[model samples]
Target: MYHTWMRFFTPGPAHHRLGLVCLGVGLQHGTLPTVGPRTLDHHVAVVVSTGRGWFRTPDGRRTAVTAPALLWLTPGVPHHYGPDPDTGWDEAFVDFTGPTADTYTELGYIEPHRPVVALSDAGAARATVGRIVRAARRGNPLLEVETSAAVHELLVTLRRARADTAPDGEQVLQALARDACKPLTVADHATRHGMTPAELRTAVRRGAGCSPKDYLLGIRLGHAKELLAATELPVAAVARRVGYDDPAYFSRLFTRRVGMAPVRFREQQAHTVPGGWSDQVPDPDDPPIIGRTPTG
Candidate 1:
C-alpha cells in the first residue's frame, strides 16, 4: 500500500505571466503502484528521496531509479514508473509549466534529454517542495504567487543538486566571476585557468549555459549597472572600472544591451536618501529603528 498527499491548482491566466506557475505538488511513500506509459502535456519533476524504483522509457527500456534522483516528465513525453514492491520509495513531485519553462530547458535547468538524473542531495529540493505543500492550503490568498515563486526556486535547487554537474566547472564559473573586471580576453582567462579556449567555452556553457565571452560580459555589465545606480562616478571612470577603457565603446555597448545610454540610466536610477545623501551602506544584520523621530 502507498501513502499519498497531493494538491492541484488551476491558476488564472494572469498568473501564467509570472513566467512559471505550479500546477500541482505531491508527497508519497510506500510501495506506490505503476504510473502511466501515457504522454503528458505539461512537465513534472518527480524527486525520489529514498528507496528505489524503475522507470520505463517510451522505447521500453527500464532504468533503475535510485534515491536522491530526479525524474523529469516533460511535455509530450511518455513515462511509466513505480517504486520497488519490496523496498518502496519516498517521493515529492512538482508539476509546473510556463513560457519560462522553455527558456529553462534551453538553459539546461530542465533536462528532458536526461530524465533520470541522480542528485547529490535531495534535502534542499524536498524543503522547497515542502513550502509548496504548505502554500497549497485551500483559500490561501497568495497561493498562486507563492507556489509559483517556489517552483522557480525548486528548479534552481534541482539543477545545482544534479550529480552530473562538474565541480571543476563550478570552480571555473567562480573564477570567472571573481575576475570579471580584469579586462582579459576569453583566451587570456582560459590560459589563467590552465584550460584551452575551447575547454573554457565548454565549461562555461555547461556550468552557466552561456559562452565564456557572454558570461564575462554579463558580469561586467551587472557591475557597471550597480555602479551607475549607486555611485556618482563619471561615465568614463565606470567604464574603466568594468574593464572597458574606452568610454565611447562602453556607452555604445551599454546602450545596445541596456536600451539606454549610461548617463540616461544613471539619471533614471538615482536614489534619494531620507536625509542628506550619505555614501555609507547600512549593515544588514542591524534591525531597523522603525517609527523613530529624526534627529537634527
Candidate 2:
C-alpha cells in the first residue's frame, strides 16, 4: 500500500573503506513492478510478503517465488521475475555488494543453489528488513554502518528461518538407517546429505545415541541375525547380501561385535522355541506399505 522506492544512497568514505554498503532498497507494491527479465551487476534479495509470482533464469529454470520467503538475484545471473498482474506480490528488497558479502558467500551463508530460503520466522525477517528501510529512509549519520549491521542480521535470519523449516537431525539419522544395506562410508553418507563428516557424527550421536558407523553396524547386525535365523544361505552369501565383501572379514568383525561367530550364532538360534525367532527379528529398512493408511 505504500509507495515503492528505488533511490540510491550517497555513501560516505567510511562506507567505502568498510567494503560494505547498501546500494538501494525498496518495498515493491503495485506502485512498482518488474518489467522483464534482466541481469544486474550487484546482488539483490526480494522477499515476497504477499500474493504470488514467478522467477525465471536464462537456463529456462523457473521458480514459484511465493510469499513467506525470499528469492536471490545474484550478480550477472540472467534472470527474470515479476508478480501476477491481478495478484501482485508485496515485496521488500535490498541491493547489496562488497567484500563482506563475498565473505558471507564463501562461508556458505549465501548459497546460490539454495536461492529461496523460507522465512519460517516471518516476523523476524520482516523486522530485520524494516531496520534496513528505516536506516535508508532517515539518511542517518551512520547509515552505512547501521544498515550493514542490519544486513548481517538479515543473513542470520535467513539461515535460522531455513533451519527452522528443515527436517530434524533424527530424520537424517533414520533416513540413513533406511539405506543401511548400501556400501557407503559414514563420510560418504554424510556428504550425500549435505553435511560434513564431523556434522554427521555429531548428528548421529545426538539423534540415535551412537556414532554413524555404529548405527549402521547395528542395522547390519540386526539384518545378519535375521538372515542367520530364518534362511539357509551360507555365511559368505549372507555376508555379501548384507554389504560385506569379504566373508572371512565379515565373520571376524561379526564375531567381535556380536560375541560369536556367524556359524555358531546360527546353530544357537536354531534351538530357540519355534515361531519366537521370527518375531525377534527386526524389520528391514524398507517395509511393505500395502496395508498402511496415507497421512496428511
Candidate 3:
C-alpha cells in the first residue's frame, strides 16, 4: 500500500512576481508517479528520498534514479521516470519555472539534458525538499517569495551534491586551495596531479561544471576578494598574494571577473560594512564560489 499528497500552486500573476514559482510539491511512499515519454511546459524535479527507480529520455537513454537522486524534467524536454513496482520508493518533488531556471541552466546548476543525478548529500537534499513541502503546505500570503527562496536553495544543494560526487572531485579542488596564491597553468595543474591536460579538463568540468581556466579564475578572484576586504594590502600586493605578478593585467582580470577594480572593491567594502567582510565565509576546503557569488 502507498500514500501520497500534493499541493499545486495556482500560477496566478502573483506567482510570476518572484524569480521562481513553485508549480507543485508532492510526497509519496511505496509508489511513484507515471512518466511516459512526453514534454512538459515547465520544469519538474522528481527526487527520490528512498527506494529506487529508472528514468528514460526521448532519445532512448535510460538512467537508474536511485535513492537520494533526482530526475529533472526540464521544459519541452521529453522524459519519463518512475519507481520499481516491487520495491516502490519514497520521494518528494517540486515543479518550478522562472527566468532563474534558464540562469541556473547556463551556470550548470541544472543540467536540462541530464535527467538523473545521485546526490552526494542525501540528507541535505531531503531536508531542502521537506522545507519546500512545508512552505507549500503553509500556503501563506508570502507563498511565492518563500517558495522561490527555497527553490534557490534546492538548486544550490543539487549543484553541490552532483559536483561532490564527480570523478576526481577533490583533487583539483585541493590543488586550488593549496595553490590559489601561486601561478599555474592548466597543463601544470594536470601534470602535477599525474593527469593529462585533457583528462584534467574533463574531470574538473565534471566536478565543477566549468573549464579549468574559469575555475582557476574563480579561485583567484575569491582569494583576491578576501584580501581586498580584510587587508590594507596595495592593489599590486593584493594581486601578488593571489598569484598575479603583473598588477595591471591582474587588475584588468579582476575587474572583468569581479565587475570592479581591486581598489574600487576595497574602497566600497571599507566604506560600508564596518569590518566589511560578509558573515558567510567561504570554506577553505570547498570549491571556489562556495559562499560568494561571482559577479562575472
Q: Pick the candidate with the highest lDDT.
A: 1
The clash tally of candidate 3 reads 0
**Residue 180 lDDT (model 2):** 85
Q: Arrange candidates by lDDT, highest first: which order?
A: 1, 3, 2
Which 10 consecutive residues of model 3 have the lowest summed lDDT?
A: 270-279
> What are the per-residue Cα lDDT tens digits for candidate 3 across 62-179?
7777787878888988887778988889887789999879888877788876788777656787788888777775647777777788889988887777634644567667775677
* lDDT (Cα, tens digit) per residue for candidate 1, span 122-216: 99999999999999998999999999999999999998999989888899999999999998999999999999999998889889988898899
Backbone clashes in model 2, listed as residue pairs: none
Clashes of each: 0, 0, 0
> Candidate 2 at 28: error in angstroms?
2.0
Q: Rank the candidates by TM-score, best first.
A: 1, 3, 2
Candidate 3: residue 52 Cα off by (Å): 3.3
lDDT of 2: 0.76
Residue 67's lDDT in candidate 1: 90
TM-score of predicted structure 2: 0.55
Regions of candidate 1 where Cα sits further than 4 Å from its true position: 271-296
Please list the Cα RMSD from the true structure of every candidate, rounded to 1 decimal place: 3.8, 15.5, 6.4
Error of 1 at 228 (Å): 2.2
